[model samples]
Target: MDLINGFITIFSSPITMLFIVMGSVLGVVVGAVPGLTASAAIAMLVPITYYIDPLSALAFLYVIGKAGRFGGSISAILFNTPGTTAAAATILDGHPMTQKGQAGKALKTASISSAIGDFTGEILLICGALTIATFTKQLGPPEYFAIYVCAFLIIGSVISSSVLKGIVSTLFGASLAMIGLDPITSEPRFTFGTIELYNGLSLVPLLIGLFVISEVFTQASHDHSKDGRHDTIKAKNPDDDHLSMAEVKRCLPFIGKGSAIGSVVGLLPGVGSAVACFVAYGEGRRKAKNGDKWGTGVIEGIAAPESANNAVSGPSMIPLLALGVPGSTIAAMLLGVFMIHGIQVGPQIFETSGDIVYGLFAAGLIGIVLYFLIGWFGSAFIGRQIDKVPPIMIYPSILAVACVSAYTARSSLFDVGLACLFGVIGYLMRVTNLSTAAAVIAFVLAPGAEQALRQSLLLSDNGFAIFMDRPVALAFFAIPVFAISLRIYSRMRSEKTPAEMLDTA
Candidate 1:
């Protein structure tokens, strides 16, 4: 009953409607712009939320997060530029589709897939957060350590362009994570007396540099794939953007499953949108009869990552809402917004702040519709802008914004210098094909993993068996092992496949 009433309170307002539309449109616009990401958009907007109620505040961020994610695909499809790093997978096939003049079909597939993913995530949040939290509580150090091992060996192994490179990247990220103060001992391990190194590396500027800055330089430096066509950008593709009525129905199942993968993957700690989208794309590819055609402009290729990446948006909120621990980088920023506002984000949020919780959910559903309305109706006009918006035009603005955002982190010019320094590091990592995902995930999990390990060990008198003593921990143990084992099996199978022999020809 309260859920119903809460929805009414949020939905009945004209202002809320305005925010939903504004957030969706703006998120898409921002996300479509290279260097302007969903997290940056939401982080920039956190200040405005202070004037609004919690429900409205979250509604704005949620709508923007959903819309911005889809918007990232636009650049990925047209220019092979992923507005968000998660959209990297989309570029594999989406850009190929654009080259084939099927940009309309690609956009349609992306929109529908994204919607399904959004629904899947929200449904999970509504149905399973409490259960999942109760279950997740048993994840002690050993279990968590196992999970990291799985992400490194399993997720990272399959994700990189190559397994050796991926393993190397995972270790690289872990090593960077180890640079900060030793959690158990208070002594700085890798700082070598550098005060800036004492707190370790900050992720935001690092993210800004690694993704946005690297791409800018890559674009400026290389013109290999530049089509003369981007120079004549417009809103809609008149000849080939529209999909046939029957074509839409065919891809729904893949889209639905992709969304499910995104949402489910997003909820698991340490798994980001990239992993969710990759794993989802892998499944969609595996299930495809035209699996061989997957990386080469297939609709399934476009749909899988598109849906999975967007689907991660809704359930990505689950951890933040249920446990106050964020599930993604953007979620971490959103967590900061809540903390800045002096609000706790847990079960009581539903009980004491029922309207806010319910309203946010309701807003999420509405945001889905709004996102489609923008994509289906507004995308062509937006899509055509690719020719008009040059990387050079946007780079200066983004560089300014990045510097300012970094400077905002304590009004320190030193932080601004640090941001630039990390930007260079980010570029170097990309050149080396290092896994930035591993680096960020390790950054997030390292301290907690350290803390949990130390506390659990003390409680058990140094007995390592405490992990096995709990059923939930035991179950958690299976995921990483299974994930790693599957990767190894898949790698072995790929090595011996008929295609492997054909490659020698």
Candidate 2:
């Protein structure tokens, strides 16, 4: 079968296997460092793969994705900082568990949950890709445009803690994404005639500045909570770790629920890991008989987030592989890396790169085994020791990686400087509660929307009614209507609360 052939190609060459191993290790390191994420890790490594076989190149990135999913938990448990937003929920109970000296239990539950969730996602991805390929063969740009509108509405409404802020963020992102090239004429519309404005702002450097560098600046301005932790984190040893089986059993149910939540949520483009975790935790507690005691360092509290966040890593790849639509902000960055490497995604990818495609799938399966080998066999020694790394030392190393990634993603030193500048802006955005997720989502969907809008208009002889000509487009328009209705209803209901009336007055 094609799958077997793909795995053979990946493993037949010892070089490919070596890269997988190296990438997994490096991914963990990147994920461990606060501010650095899996997407940045893959981008930093992508250029290194240009000369290698495509299968090997993909294999390396696959490992990074797998390990990066788990790596974020390392920081979330050790410190309150989550390396990825997916791990944000992990800090809710993980850091508290660590403070309680139940660090081993928390880490163990997290590791197992992550592994199971990731494995489940891989299964769904393989199945979904095959089905999607068969069903979507006839999809046109108009269909894609409708999907983009749907995505904007869903992500804007669901991802934001505040729907109003979320809606605003989505609009802001769209406006910025429209800054450079005109989709129809390829003429510059918003560029003010400056060379710097011609290309619009680059996303990778902007992401680096906003997510990684800005956090460093923000942290610099604050007086951190002091536990007098060590400056540098050493690599964890696989030996000398310990855990009780009773605790492991207690976490199993949570892991199962988390994985289930991840598999379902990840199928959507905008949900991402953070949403998965919060949803999983809420659902798990809702389903638990001992729900009242859920937050007091229970295994369920730890396992739910650990499973959901990691599970997303595999399923999030579904859109990227099937439609070239990225499911998460990090996946968007990886899409750039794939483009840079001359790897074209979409239905044809399976036909053209069966070996590479299959290899990536097989790698996810094998990575589970590798994760267990590292996390289970080595946690006691690695977990306790890794917990001591302070933010000051860890953050700078993240900036270094981001700088390298910005340069690598674009092959421009200007990207590095731009990333730093964006870092400052990102920091300010965080302080003001502006949504970076909104911006990233906007960047990814903007080009497609513009292309579709123009194409549809041309086909319709420049009539604005083109959007309602198709059932799909009509449904897409319903999104804004639905979102607005929900916002209004929620607002009207909220008006009766004493706190709301006080704020309004």
Residue 157 shift from truth in candidate 1, angstroms: 4.3
Number of the top candidate by lDDT? 2
What range of 10 consecutive residues in model 1 has the weakest lDDT sum?
A: 496-505
In the range 113-189, model 1's lDDT, one tens digit per residue, is 77777777877877666565565554555665554444445545554666677667667656776777887787888
Model 2 misses residue 499 by how many Å?
17
Candidate 2, 372-480: lDDT as tens digits: 5666555444544555666677666766876877787558887788788777777776777777767777776778778877777777854777666677667766876
Per-prediction TM-score: 0.76, 0.84
Lowest-sum lDDT 10-residue window in model 2: 232-241
- Relative to the unseen true structure, what is the C-alpha lDDT of residue 91 in candidate 1, on a scale of 0 to 100? 85
